[model samples]
Target: MPSLNVSFSDEEMEGVRAAAAAEGKSLKQYLHDLGVREMHRKRFVAGATAWADKLRGEFDEAFPEEIPPAQRGDGAAAA
Candidate 1:
């Protein structure tokens, strides 16, 4: 795999080093984990947004208020 060169301030580098040391990981491994986590989070949000849009379209196509907020579990505790 190809590597990209990035520059950061001395303070930033120190912070990364300290964090990696605390976690018992090399700086490279720490950065790799961070990047992977962010990518995973973005992919999850994209999937959820697509599903929500599809559901909204279906809800509109059916009845506007046929599915009430309470029935949809809108923040209320389930019975």
Candidate 2:
């Protein structure tokens, strides 16, 4: 695994240490877990977005005459 070198002021370091200790983790483990969680969140959002687009396409195909709310001129859908 690649290593990262981070620099923090004394106060910042103390705060980070306290947080890690509160979580019962070493500083390195706490930071690593944060990175992993962020990665998973991005993946989940990407998958959800792709699924929504696919579902929308199917809906449009099934209802060819239906105008999307945004295109209605009667103010039924707020911009």
Candidate 3:
């Protein structure tokens, strides 16, 4: 397994320690979990973006005659 070493001021360390204790985790475990959660969040966002792009393409194909909401003169919201 690889390791990461980070530096923090005393005040920052104290705050981190308090947070870890509040979560019933050691500082290292808290930080590790944070990293894992961030990775999962990023993957979720990427997947969602790809899905939206595909949906947009399909919507355009299905409604070629319609003007997109953004281009409407009245700036009406899409139904």
Q: Which stretches of candidate 3 lie over 4 Å from their true place?
A: 58-79
Candidate 3 has a TM-score of 0.68
lDDT of 1 by residue, 1-79 (tens): 9887878799999999999999999988999998999999999999998998879877777877666455876546543
Best by TM-score: 3
Worst 10 residues of 3 by lDDT: 70-79
Ranking by TM-score: 3, 1, 2
Pick by TM-score: 1 or 3, better one: 3
In model 2, pairs of residues that clash are none
Q: Select the stronger candidate by lDDT from 2 and 3.
A: 3
RMSD values, in order shown: 6.2, 5.1, 4.7
lDDT measured at residue 79 in model 2 versus the true structure, 0 to 100: 41
Estimated TM-score for each candidate: 0.63, 0.61, 0.68
Q: Write the per-residue lDDT of candidate 2 for residues 1-79, one digit (tens) a residue.
A: 8989999999999999999999999999998997899999999999998998879988899999988777878666554
Kindly report the root-mean-square deviation of model 2 from the true structure over all alpha carbons: 5.1
Badly placed stretches (over 4 Å) of model 2 are 57-79
Q: Score each candidate by Cα lDDT.
A: 0.85, 0.91, 0.92
